[model samples]
Target: MSAETPGPRRSNYSSMPVAYAAIGASSAPDLLRFPPAESTPYEETLQLGSGTERFLTAANLLMTWGAQRVAGVEVVDIDPGEPSEYPGVHFTETGTPELGAAREELFTPEGEAYLLAGTTASFVVGSKDPRRILVVTTVNESNRLGFAWGDRDEVAGYGEQQLTVEIREDSTVWAVARGFTFQSSTGITAGLKQRAHVKEAVAQAQAFLQALAPGAALRNGVAKPADEPDENDQSADDQPSA
Candidate 1:
């Protein structure tokens, strides 16, 4: 193992200036929401591709709770066992015309072949110090998919989030996450807050396409930074919006 590692804590800044790290490095623009406060709503969007079944199919992988076990994250509880486990890990079909009215192709209700509108699951983010659980509130494929338990469990605040990926009439495929979380988590430390959970979602969005179609270059969505630099349209930092 190397003597140095990447994590939330470090002493490198002890001998240096600027509060444990370079201001530019630690103060990267958070494309989530700014003026971070309690009960705030955050959204991050990404342009994936043209509207088509192919893109929706890629998104379906996320709704099916399959991506939770991907490269950087892993499912912690995503299986149906007993009723005592009221919040049993399971996927239920949210019948959309895309899957047929009866959703037969989705498999028997008790079958493990698919996920519907109400499907939900849980997962952890980091390998060394998995901090919080990402919870799902809804998983309606191709129509309306969302989450209702992340910001609450994470930010000492509470809110739900939904990711909508759809092709517009112009054939542009867009994926966006809309959610609410408390402005400040009571117990979480400073470095952790700076991680920007919204950014993680954005990365996950990109990963969806990467997994479905490797080498695909998903475009980043632009957000208006909370603060613009004096006399300059850009923020105090030169970083572009993610």
Candidate 2:
């Protein structure tokens, strides 16, 4: 998505009826074109004073699109930005009509299928780190999905993972958690699936960042310098004993 495309402007649900269709036409095609590939992982360093909110927002947009299209799920945008009664948990409602049924459908088997599909899409969109730092699971009843981001201490330093569980009235659920340490210093070099999504997500994030801060670089994982000084710079006097 181009920065000129606009940022989270009033949700695209109205203009676009089928969310999946829009994603397939816009972002999916690009992702399919440049699939992720594994190579020597290296981090992309951002200039000091860079803001990461743009990247996070981009990621959220992609996740929203994928979730809507793949699982037929809609993320709830709770105003006031306050924590819900569930504490750390947010709520969204979904329903469908039964052919001749009126007042719109709130829960149904079809809705459940849509939720499952959307969850898969959301997972694919959010899953970037090749280390398998994130895992997505499904819950049939209660229409909820669970995501488990594994403990970070296992891979990185003292860090904690994030877990997100989503449920729709139709009994569709999506859950995700931070599983592994993601090093931005090493660009995603895992495999096609990993690289493609990450690259696209990163690119989209970059676009958003550029808009937010023209020259600032948004760092997602770890930051590392690209170029190292030549060994010749080390004087003989400074050389260590062989």
Candidate 3:
């Protein structure tokens, strides 16, 4: 007899309850897998501290949070204008209305991590300027932050020139300080004094963050709804109508 060829095999599988049960049994654990835990509000609050401490900590925290969150970091030493370089750092001419100075640079990985982890903004008193100055800058995001100054001779009169720092989208930060005679308003002294005020404001903001949330990431000082959902993927039925 000639050898017989085997025909195509047919699967006897059907919607058998036992087989279905077995299939479900094998897959059930997958459905039970837990989702990743989210960062707690308390933890987030702790990440963002206040004052020089907070500023430093927030800068450091940003490294892990994301690049966009960090932006940049600046530390202004408002003394009789000393040579501006941080050792392993670079600077470039920003611009000015008159005879002033401004610059910016990138942070190294160590610097980025350190700032993101936590660092304190430092201030030093300068002899030529005779004013304590604070340096302010971003932490980890990018090089798009700047500083500026303005001043007036009369204490009661408005400011003449406004010192301004601007970070363009292209990752350039600049600063300018100037003095002029203008109508009454808030006047700032173009040089060291204006720098000092900027420092003070930064310090105050830092302290506020620390006191508000010791270790939480500092939120950008932008307005947001109090009861907004944490994630956007939720369906319309999942969210309350505005």
TM-score of 3: 0.17
The residue-by-residue lDDT of candidate 1 on 202-238, one tens digit each, is 4555554343331232222222112212332322232
lDDT of 2 by residue, 1-242 (tens): 22122211123455321211111111111222321121111112122121232222212222223222222223232121112211121112221111111111122211211121112111223434322221112122222222222211223211112223333344333233221122223345534444454454444333322322212212322121111122234322211111
State the C-alpha lDDT per candidate. Answer: 0.36, 0.23, 0.24
lDDT of 3 by residue, 130-210 (tens): 222222222122321222121212232112111222234443333222222122233464444544543444443344334
Poorly placed runs, candidate 1 (over 4 Å):
1-37, 80-112, 116-120, 128-136, 139-159, 184-242
- Superior by TM-score: candidate 2 or candidate 3: 2
- Estimate the TM-score of every prediction: 0.45, 0.20, 0.17
| Whole-model lDDT, model 1 | 0.36
> What root-mean-square deviation over C-alphas does model 2 reach?
22.4
Name the candidate that leads on TM-score.
Answer: 1
lDDT of 2 at 9: 18
